[model samples]
Target: MNNQLPPPPAQMMQLITGFWTSCCVYSAAKLNIADHLKDKPQTAHQLAEATHSDAPSLYRVLRALSSVGVFKENEDHQFELTSLGNTLQTDAPGSMKAMAIAQLGDHYNAWGNLVYSIKTGHIAFDNIEGMSVWKYYEMHPEEGVNFIKAMSGLTGAVIQHVLPEYDFTSFNTIVDVGGGNGALLVAVLDKAPQAKGIVFDEEYVVAETKKLIAKKGFSSRCETAAGSFFEFIPENADAYLMKMVLHDWNDEQCLQILNNCNKAMKAGSKLLVLDSVIPEGNEPHPGKFMDINMLAMTGGRERTEKEFASLFSNAGLKLARVIPTHSPMFSIVEAIKE
Candidate 1:
């Protein structure tokens, strides 16, 4: 005696249209359409003319995005920014413009060959560039800069969440082991006046952090060191922090990095890993998708609480606590050297 049947399944069409949506988003980013409409609405014709794209085709793309809430289809073929669409505006404080462009840019091609990674367990970047992503980036500085910019922009939101949760007051010295441009290093130093800081990474990355250190007028207290975390790290710091670093590698690589941190630390020194912990079971979390992205890209993973603790224990350390923040998207897992 059922009165109605369930709605038709939207899964297949949604999955099939994912690329179309990505291309739509990419087109908007490339044309600066989001930036153009940040302050006001624009008609399809106006946007097409401004971006020099085909009016009809561009309108179709915009319409499709409007259907998905990236933009609004106001009356008279005009488009206005939706809340979700504002993330693509570069001038916005917490902009994801760079992330969108990068995801939909060179990486998109690599992702197209996801089956290659799935079948072979080798990186698609290696297939594309005849080398790993790091090597390719090292050989191409322009691309490397874009890669860094994309990472920095993506991490900005997460770091803003992390800034308040942890108490940085107690430690006099904090070392960002894999700190990229010293953004978090600068943030920590500014908040904790008593803390001296060291921003450590490869030469190319840490070199630029010096300018930031200079800008912060902590030139004397804050310094940059060039090194690799795998081989060894600058030792004897009161505390060490790595943000969004470990998930870029497999468990063995993660253990190597953590062991390096442990070797460099005295008893009671802290190691902070800022990353997403893949919660157990099918409970639904963004990290599950990210875990797959890691698998496809670097053969890495977004780990769970137990996985994190095991990694810490493997490195001759113990899990101190899993500190949650306002942003459930990331957490700080603290481990102390044995």
Candidate 2:
């Protein structure tokens, strides 16, 4: 007989009820609770007043999050910021506060309809929100702006890891296809001071991207181009970068974008696709979960190395290699135009 019994049932329950924890963190972030506690410990009542939340209810949520190491609830019912909680602070460098709001607040409704996606193989975001995510952002400009900030926050940390691992020394001009707010493109140009860049996106996004590029003093080295990736990209760049862009699209849509890039590239030019590659086994990887998130929200799916190779081949490009970086969430899926 096998020596071990089945594991405790509570673990299963915790997994099933994981959304409860997600919502608590989302609520805390939305209330700006960490910002309030940045200076010192504060009782729940004080926090409630600052955030305009119910004192008892706020206390319960904070107490729960405290158990998970997000905050420390003292003997006196005061809460102090923990290292993990500090990352939620609005002013913290690489802060995830906006991302928390976007994912758990703005994207939460779509995620709730995950079963719809499984049944119909359609985008849950469209079903629940009455339009695609891009259209929804167009209608709600403020939310769109917040979403951009959230993306910047998430990518800011990722770019630091990417810059050191990838070499841009040889490329003179690079283009960031679907680059939002020009954060990643600016970072790239800053690193390769001799290299120039272009931030290509929809008209509205490029309007804002211009401001960001100028703000970073990359106006001299970086410029903005407004267009759809499915139609055209700037031509003849030494390198084309699509970071976190491919995973937001289905294969057909991704191929359309890639075909455009292929047409825009010179024979020896490169395409640097930065995204998480789903590992082959059952080994724990965040991309496996994030793939489902893409399916739910964007009608996109993350891929394995084999899938990426197929994508490149279909788009008339050749997969060169997959370069690992310090960041586990993404890798450089390098390809060359044939």
| TM-score versus the correct structure, for each prediction | 0.91, 0.94
Candidate 2 lDDT by residue in tens digits, 1-338: 89785587967888889989889999999899999999999999999999988999999999999999999988887999999999899878678888888889779898889999999999999999899998999899878888888888767777777768988989999999989889898888877878999999999889978888888888888999999998899999999999889999999999999999999999999999989998998899889989999989999999999999999999999999999888788899999986
Candidate 2's C-alpha runs over 4 A off are 1-6
Which residue pairs clash within candidate 1?
Answer: none
Backbone clashes in candidate 1 total 0
Worst 10 residues of 2 by lDDT: 154-163
> How well does candidate 1 match the true structure in TM-score terms?
0.91
Go through the candidates in order and give each one's C-alpha lDDT: 0.84, 0.91
Candidate 1 Cα deviation (angstroms), residue 23:
1.9
Quote the positional error of residue 177 for candidate 1 in Å: 1.7
Quality of model 1 by C-alpha lDDT = 0.84
Q: Which has the greatest lDDT?
A: 2
Query: lDDT by residue for model 1 over 1-338, one digit each (tens)?
Result: 98674455666667667788888898888889898898889988999899998999889989989999999988777899999999888766567777777778757767777888888887775686677778877888777777787777756776688778988888888999889888788888878889999898999888888987788688977899898999998788888998889999988898899888888999889988888987777798888877777766666889889999999999999999999887776898999986
Give candidate 2's error at residue 149 in angstroms: 1.6
